[model samples]
Target: MLGAIVGDIIGSAYEFNNTKRKEFHLFTPKSKFTDDTVMTLAVARWLCGDKEHRKETLVRHMQELGRRYPTAGYGGSFMRWLHNPEPQPYNSYGNGSAMRVSPVAFYAHSLQEALGLAKISAEVTHNHPEGIKGAQAIASSIYLARHGATKREIKSYAEEQFHYDLSPQLDDIRPTYSYDMSCQNTVPQALLAFLEGANFEDVIRIAVSLGGDSDTIAAMAGSIAQAFYGIPQNLASYCYALLTPYLRTILNKFEESIGVLTPDPFDIERFIKAQNDDNTYQQALKEILQGHKTSHWIWYIFPQLKGLGHSTYSQYYGLADTDEARTFLANPCLNERLREITNALLIYKDRNIERLMGSSIDALKLKSSMTLFDAISPNDIFSKVLDVFYDGKKDRNTLQIISKTFNGHISNN
Candidate 1:
């Protein structure tokens, strides 16, 4: 959990750095926690509550904390769900799972129980499969790490279990947000950040530098790193005053359940134990962890986030980077034109109006359509939105034609 805290602080500083180097203050008077911390507190608070149905516990706690900390960036769909007379989950699969999964990992008596609780807690808000998968992956990794799994063992299991491409390199993820948001992508990457890390601070630097969902990715990676690496003496020593009097008590409650953790330092042996004859393990390892490759947008997006105001994140924070602009997009309603290829193909591939002439799917339902034009107007919103996005200098019809042609490369049916 403190890993999440440290990740929050570390990434808080360099969220847009795109590439990482460890040279900065660990936390600041302005280095406050985000929804990542608040929701984590919610999960931790409820896991220790009455042994009621896990979903009920989660809803109650999430609702309570969300109201208590209404200002922290929350996904919009979730916020709407929160105020509705009867809350029902919107099938969202954002990075919320990765951020709030640690409490179960440390608290569960066994692996199965930890996984079960992680699943239940995830479903309370994120009904989407990818969301559930992402949460489970993070919690399981935390469980393995706490129970004495080595970095190699954790990486191997994550790769084998989820088929993640676990490359530890962070040079490419910056400036864009296009990686898969599923456990297959998000969890393993976060773990690899810790697995390849040298210490608590290293974990955050690696995660934020890797980009994609920078803050959440770093926060998730940090949560796991805390357990594997243990809190830094310097950090815990100095973190005392960062919290409000309220959080100080919360930390004590957080520690109360620490007694139940049962780490089995030998789990790593299980991986190597197969080394005796399982020739297949090597091939499997290669297949899953082949390349932890990432793209370049991870670098650019950080600057965009930090540069949103008169102060760049680095300038405002008096640190290298600390932008919180993307927090507004937490609502899950505002679509960033960015997406993982898998998700893009699933939700937006042919939904565009450009494809109406070339494809069969409904074009009116495209999110871009909603953003571009209101149906109340007879004018084609698609053409108008294109004109605006590109400036009125370009022909609206020509832009629509261009969008269709480019979209064809990605759409087959």
Candidate 2:
């Protein structure tokens, strides 16, 4: 649920001023929660508040929250329903249904419960078939992800059950996609972004890069990504900080109700001071970006990587600890270009940490990303990196510069 809210806030700035590029800042001065966060919290409150799961309860919460955050960029029809004395299902097919449905996934113990609850949540206003389907599809994907289903299995289930064509890659979808609010147009693209992403942050970046209803698309994708690949601690802290106290209180209750302990946000001042105190944090980033894959820096930094649930990135990747992460990073067969791109990804991850810190990610997320980076074929990694950092357009000069810089470093060594 926080993952969805994080995406909403990050993409909020870019929703109106759409940027097809993924290199933009994750947050800005203008960034804030929108209708997506408000309605999502409403659904969450309904799930946690009402033991009977009544539709009337859902409607009341939605109306109350919506009225409180009236300028949250809600669609006109939904706004009318929020204020109406006799609100009814408007039979709308908007992506709003999918954006707010993530909480149902976290609250459900089984896939069927997820689908059923998703239906109840959507029908309050979006009684249209696509709206219900959209909600169910996202809810089911997140449920499957949390239950340890592989991406392939989740993709097959969504394709077979929801009949969404998850086959189209983001590279193919980004060039021609436009501003679309309908569930049919929004849900599939969001799901596809999740399917193609390398990590949780990667998924958000991919969804935002698609450039249509950016926040909702990223929100839907981020929810599933969080289920599949748990969010980094730094990112989670940023998410919590951007939210209101009431929203955070509801979020805390919702998580507690589901048997999940809400993580406390890191003290930014202390975190920044820790970074300044540890020279290896900066040194590791510098050496890795310079194309030297030393295991000692990784070992040094792993101890400082404090996270919420999982301890280290290696563990997240199913390995034991920093030793396993080091072994994974020391892949012998990666060609020159693949190694350079891997270094570039490490640099990219470092930048994300800097941005979020205002500053080490749980370096576990970074290590796990590298572990996955090593597992994928070189071609796919190259394509994904270009799509993300280079905006899906392969700029040979950039690759050439990375290669040359790496070669220069090797010669100096």
Candidate 3:
């Protein structure tokens, strides 16, 4: 799956100290992987055993795995449930589902298969509806990336399926966005990062900077990014060199089982080789931008990209889409209720748009969003957008600079 170990380990130190800064020590004594890592490895190993038997033995093994990794930073209630001597789900709604669900997607080749394994993985501990939804959203994202989903399609899928509104305005979600132990908030927002990302690396940055349950959020976003971006050679090498040998070995074995011989030897050559099939989308994106630049929304939306095209830039510069011009519009006011918000997020996954133009995302808790308005195309967004300037004029100016910088990167690249 998508760098589950990397995600868990990276997030280990920052469960409470969520920050966008990338300068933190990766492996201090305080920096340790949590139950998320433990459970993910367990699932990866189990999938290497048998795919069809997933349902029959997943929960049994999960319970055992939880016991084996007892002090791996589990929730208090989860620990209590784990220690009960019998396997009874405490019915969690935590981000744990989103944390440890990469293998479900990796092992299952199809969407249906992926979701089935996701259901199994979730029910093992997080039997709540929200837990299942998070797992499914993350799992579906991984599966889609493997199938070659566009950035817009992936974000659209996640927002629709998980009820994420990727408005650059955190205020939309922040006032009600809390640290409660449920996958509903964490998974959806994490998906928001992945959906809006221009490439793989930014997915991690967006999730990391979004600031709630930072590690898992970044981890989940990173997983999908890896699936789509296929990991760069240099960064993958650094990640592998820093990872515990045991983890490196586990990943090697997992890759082997999936018919991939070299998993972590990512290098510039390998990245270039990997992109032998990438076509000229990056180039095309640059052409779209013209002169219109990216907004602050780009930072949280697109984290690790080098640039965009003028055409790509111009397309996204269009206004945000609103239903005011249409007759059959979605119910935006539904977000007044949490259930409506949650339900709207999940169902929206079905409308994976083929083309998205403009900066306008369907921020309302609606069931689906078709482009009524768009300020930019998907390829030009970036993470610098998370800066959160109070001055509206500066923010627009900043987005334009980012957009130009983005296009410049594509042209130069």
Residue runs of model 1 more than 4 Å from their true location after superposition: 16-22, 172-185, 260-413
Q: How far is candidate 1 from the true structure (C-alpha RMSD, Å)?
A: 22.3
Q: What is the lDDT of residue 115 in candidate 2?
A: 98
lDDT of 2 by residue, 1-413 (tens): 88898888888888988888878878665677889989999999999999889999999999998887777898999999999989999999999899999999999888899999999999999999999999999999999999999999999999999899888777877899999999999999999989999999999999899997999999999999999999877667666655555566688889889888753442233222333455644655555565444434332232211122233432222322222223334433223323553445545542543232221443333333433333333455544644443344533332332343231121110
Q: Rank the candidates by TM-score, best first.
A: 2, 1, 3
Clashes of each: 19, 2, 60
- Candidate 1 lDDT, 1-413, residue by residue in tens: 76776576555544434334445555543455667777887888887774664687678878877776666666678788767667877787877876888888877889898888888888887878878878888888889988899888888877787567776464454445344544556666687778778987788777776655556777788878877888755454334223333444455576666663322111212222332234533333332233211222111121121111233332331111111112222313222322221122333323332342122211212222222222222244333443433232333332342243231111111
In candidate 1, what residue range of length 10 has the lowest lDDT sum? 317-326
Top candidate on lDDT is 2
Point to the candidate with the largest TM-score: 2
User: Model 3 Cα RMSD, Å?
Assistant: 21.8
lDDT over C-alpha atoms for residue 21 of model 2: 81
Q: Is candidate 1 or candidate 2 better by lDDT?
A: 2
- Evaluation by TM-score, superior candidate among 1 and 2: 2
Instruction: Estimate TM-scores for all models.
Output: 0.59, 0.67, 0.58
Q: Global lDDT for candidate 2?
A: 0.72
Per-candidate local distance difference test: 0.55, 0.72, 0.54
Clashing pairs in 2: 313-364, 354-359
Q: Sort by lDDT, best first.
A: 2, 1, 3
